[model samples]
Target: METPALEVQLQTLPSSPGVYQYYDKNQKILYVGKAKNLKKRVTSYFTKRHDSHRIGVMVKKIKEIKHIVVESETDALLLENNLIKKHQPRFNVMLKDDKTYPWICIKNERFPRVFPTRKLVKDGSEYYGPFTSFKTVNTLLDLIKGLYKLRTCNYDLSEEKIRNGKYKVCLEYHLGNCKGPCEAKQPEAEYNSNIEAIRQIVKGNFKESLQQFREQMKQHAEKMEFEDAQRIKNKIDVLENYQAKSTVVNPKITNVDVFSIVSDEGYGYVNFLQLSHGAIIRSHTIEMKKKLDETDEELLELAITEIRQRFSSKSKEIYVPFKVDAGEDVKVTIPKLGDKKKIVELSQRNAKYYRQERFKQMKIVDPDRHVKRIMAQMKEDLRLQVAPTHIECFDNSNIQGTNPVAACVVFKNGKPSKKDYRKFNIKTVEGPDDFASMEEVVFRRYKRLLNEGEDLPQLVIVDGGKGQLSSGVKALEALGLRGKIAIIGIAKRLEEIFYPGDSIPLYLDKKSETLKIIQQLRNEAHRFGITFHRNKRSKSALNTELEEISGIGEKTVIELLKQFRSVKRIKEASEKELAEVIGVSKAAIIYKYYKSKKET
Candidate 1:
């Protein structure tokens, strides 16, 4: 970021309010900001003599800039919030938080009771707020409970007293907490009216509801109900305090979601903060990964696209990690001032924290400078005469006797090479024959490596015991690559490590770092292989019954399977529900056959 470049970007910006983006030399987003006057705001960063060290650092890294001119300052503010959330750039003040908004859920029942909740349920309950503060929401709930005398207990009074003939209403009525309509102590009409009034307050009708409460308070005082009047006044005060603290909304900016993406090396994290009518509502994070060799520009490009595909199409504006290369559907920019600036700065702070955490995990003071210790550990544990630059592990997957597959996952240094992962469909092995599958996969893999004249792996690992290890050795022997590549086998529990022709399994000391690294690699390979295998098996199971059904061709069977998960669920469905399934009709002869089988 330089003064001349800042001036150049500011000169081109529109006067309208929107988001702005500042990018570093590697084209990573350095900072995101929102501005009311884009030109005036962006230019401030260049001319300000008393800029803080954080801003100075950001300015140094900035090589490129971008902006989006939105409808109003409020839109700019919201878009800025979204971008900061998405990018988490490096020069902002972020609120220390994971606190989500709370909502008041009115249970769907004969006697509905309002409850405070963070998660919204789809079971016909009316959810409100997603209030800024949990304490405020709770206070309101308490006020409603005190004023209405509604049953706070979740237990069903009607079901308990009427249907089951259970216990009687006890203390709630005597203590004035509940109306006790369960035993007809209070009239249904009065209780229902109070419930409706509570609904009004939850719906944000504070002004009207306050007047009604005051009128009721006056009536209670006339009847010498001093305590009741005081309670009503307290409820009114709670509503006023909450309303005063909420952000004032500008009519133009009704709904907006802010996003920010921060990347360092090959890793990135996206933060999302949502606002409705200028009130902060929702927030989330998205983590990204790249190869250790990947550049900042390359990583940011992928991260922005991923964030857009996931969160942008549904949102009005897309705040990004850096200015996109162009041809994006939504506008992107960095904020220069106002509300959006605060959000962008916050995002930067979070990104800095995220990057720092990643650096700590890498542990090395200078990761670029390879240590001799790392190389030595790699050589001895893999049992290669030379240090292994690349390690490849293999595993076999199948369910009983079906959909067998083998996986080969590669690792560079100690991390996964996801791009080099390969899967083999077992063409020869039937049932859960791990040994045969290992042999076939090993032969096919190495045969290609040799034919292609590719660099041979210094080490090869198979996730199995002696039988699979022997199969791997035989495959390598057939290819004349047996001694060229060092092979090792990992066994579970008592049998830890095995190699072909070894008298006993080899167990590394528990305290060895080399063993820990190898175990991690082995677990990752097994996990990847098992996940693919199980998915294939499940698909096979779902296809089996459909394939065997007479009069059900592949197309019709595919349609039915897609609509219903299993044959059993489909059979249990009524004729009407069955007819609604694609390619199924009441008049179709196939329907009659399925119905006959269901009855039998």
Candidate 2:
């Protein structure tokens, strides 16, 4: 690997617009970053005095540095965002929060009402807020609607009354919740004034609005209107409760971002809490299964830098539960006292809580022990360059040379990423030629990946020894991924593992947890492949007669099968039973076959 090529490219870049990529020696991308001034930003890392520990580490591993200079900064920004999304760079600040924040939209009507929305529209509708908590936003919406009796219905009042001239006062008018302009029960001017009260309430101006309500209550009390005074007092109480609940924790810091990382074994979880004016505005969480050797401090530093680059800063202080050794002049503090402490404590608690949840669900996978050992032994046994993080396994299945299907299962960080699991029907090779079927499936898979210039898996395991392994390896090499990814042949005995080079079945060391872990992984892949193959065979057998019959096409066969149940039953059915099918005829040759088969 020409590792220095990466460093040289970074050094030779001109002070102009461009994008730069950092790739490991194997050409797998570590990070994708774009810069408006390519030479200044890319070359900054090489500065002797300015070399931060993180930058130094990144520079040392720069095996291949590629650049693309765009015409403008805007183009660079767009390209940067796109590449970040496409590659999901390991070092970039990722938007861990996939759930969108909600905004309140008020229709552009004379009597507008609030609606919760995730998307912003350029239509005339007005919107406010991107509230973090659904409960908080919903409660405020209800309180305002109850107090001011603003219409909650989406019906356009102005269009109904003016354009269509169709209107009516609702029950809210009788309940004294609304100033009823529709009924003409309250003056139009009074109703308009009530609308302004709603506007003030939503803008968080409760003091001014409450003071006016208080005066109204007092005047009613002086007039000996006890019932009216009590009603106004109740409204004031509701408003006071809302204000009390909306207490700002840290007024000095308007916007603060807090981060926390919890690690268990090799897995890491990063959590972010965004606070605006001392109140939490949003929170984000990301769970990672990284290399076991990657340190917590290193992961936290990378995660923080990535997050900061993605979310624009609104606060002067950034809180982190883990100590970051970035040495940046930013206020990096573990909360010691007061509300900041409480916020940090809450965030830590949440991170731990989420970690525990993941741990519980993932307890079935004991990768830390048996699986890791098995993989390491397999690597040494196969003379692999590194421990595999991403492994793809292939297996072919069929019954008596009947239906052939292939399965591909992916394991990331020693655990099955079932999302990437794939099943393929043997297209090129038919009738249970396991070796050729494996070749076709593997070839089809890698050809597309190589054509797209995609990353190959760290290891590819075939379910058979030399024959199957050779087929898979040849396919990979054809796609120019042969030496790039490790290849292993796992031919299983009744209760043991058989490798290509070794004649003896390799039973893992009984004492090693890692060995047992690898066995479990191999077994899982076998089980998944077998399951998919069985399903394919079963479906094919059931559809065999339909596939073979000429005049009895798909639709007719489908109707006959639906009405008769199975192929076995369809073949055994009398002609009358076949004729009873909605689309089948009494004189149909297929029905005669069914009748003859039943008689025999």
Candidate 3:
């Protein structure tokens, strides 16, 4: 379906590193991509079939092709990222992060001021971070305040103003919170030294600060400045405590960025762990909605570039779970063992937890979306033609070949529909023939539904192995519903799922939602069947006791039992009480029978 203009454009595309933009008929941007070979990459889209339906549709909509030839692949990547953000293309990878994170800004002044800011002002000042939370910013600020006495006032502390005696020491100086930098009580070199330590601390590196503080304390202690040394010791304790919480791996794993991804059919989550001196200074997980069903490598590469730029990370090396194209400047390591691998695994775990949290929030905020996602997932996992919105599970229950019965529990939209539960008395099948009982109940359940013009379930789950499954399939085949409705069997021992003809069973993940629902269905059917079987046995016992009387018919026995409530109560009751309930002749037979049985 390529137009003549597009075909000609594709043929003439340069085999150079560049970024490409696909536009629709109205000059509306659809997608943005970067490639080392523009011609080969663009040509493959039109030449080969795309597995993703969305990708195929986007390709078909491309009425115009635009190219920006860059000097290198890195330049192409940067250009692609910029253009995608500028145009906000419809089919580009959509990063689901929009929060304005806080950054620590060091003011460019004679007396530099340090504070947290959400806005990034382009001046001569240095900004350390765009931290994910304000609490972390506050914690670092508190640590700095506790360690060093930096002026909190916004007054200009220029040399000219201090020389003119324009400012005086404030209450903060009185409280020892500031060294009166405004009034020049604190020397510029000393304040600047403290700022340097603060910079290192914000970068999650406390070694230099700790070493300096220990030396200062040693010098103070040798000079008999015991109070100052004690103060420095307290500062070291504070810094070490903070460092202990931040450090996650071996101290040798320093200045490394660990990036790991976990994805599903609809979205991908990439967790970035920023480590400095083996300490995790910052961690973030970004969710990206899939466009063109992009591979993990593609998503991870793009995310790493974007996140590093966003967080201003300058790490030369990164640890990943797989190989990626992060440009020539960056070294990528696929960790296979030891601490490197554990960090990657920790990143993946964070991504998984984030995904689970998002799912939980979605379920609460938008239940319809939640149900739709689960239904779609169930359809794919169970390999059904459509979602099993209405499912019925059958289980047979009997103890010692007595009161044999089968119970069918219904589930709609992955939840139990208790009202639709059906119980079948094993009439045709005798003894504990589970296979025959299953076949009979499966046939009877559907046969009645068909007879009554009621809708059938989209799926049928038989609670047993292949024997029970084969029997259920036979019933479906007899009712001409083999292919129309999907059926599966669940084995209790291994939790294996079996299909109609496939001898091999499908073992789902132990933690998978699909397997959980199947287990719920199986357990529910068993519980319902067991309860029915127990009740049936109790009733049969009750009927045998009274129905065995000489003149008591089933109806008379029922009437007497309904009046007395139990057989023991009937036996305890006087003849006058029984006559008042059943009748004089039947009451006399029942009372005399019980008396003779008691005497014997």
Each prediction's RMSD over C-alphas, in Å, is: 24.3, 17.1, 3.3
lDDT (Cα, tens digit) per residue for candidate 1, span 406-468: 899997776688998888899987678889899999999999988898888878889888888
TM-score of each: 0.38, 0.47, 0.89
Candidate 3 lDDT for residue 106: 92
lDDT of 3 by residue, 490-542 (tens): 99999999998899999998988888999999999999999999989978997
Task: Give me the candidate number with maximum TM-score.
Answer: 3
The residue-by-residue lDDT of candidate 2 on 361-474, one tens digit each, is 555676365456445555654456777767888877775776677788888767789988888888887466888988899999888777888767878877877788778877
* Model 3 pairs whose backbones collide: none
TM-score, candidate number 1: 0.38
Model 3 misplaced regions, further than 4 Å: 9-18, 35-52, 67-76, 398-402, 430-432, 551-600
Judged by TM-score relative to the true structure, which candidate is superior, 2 or 3?
Answer: 3
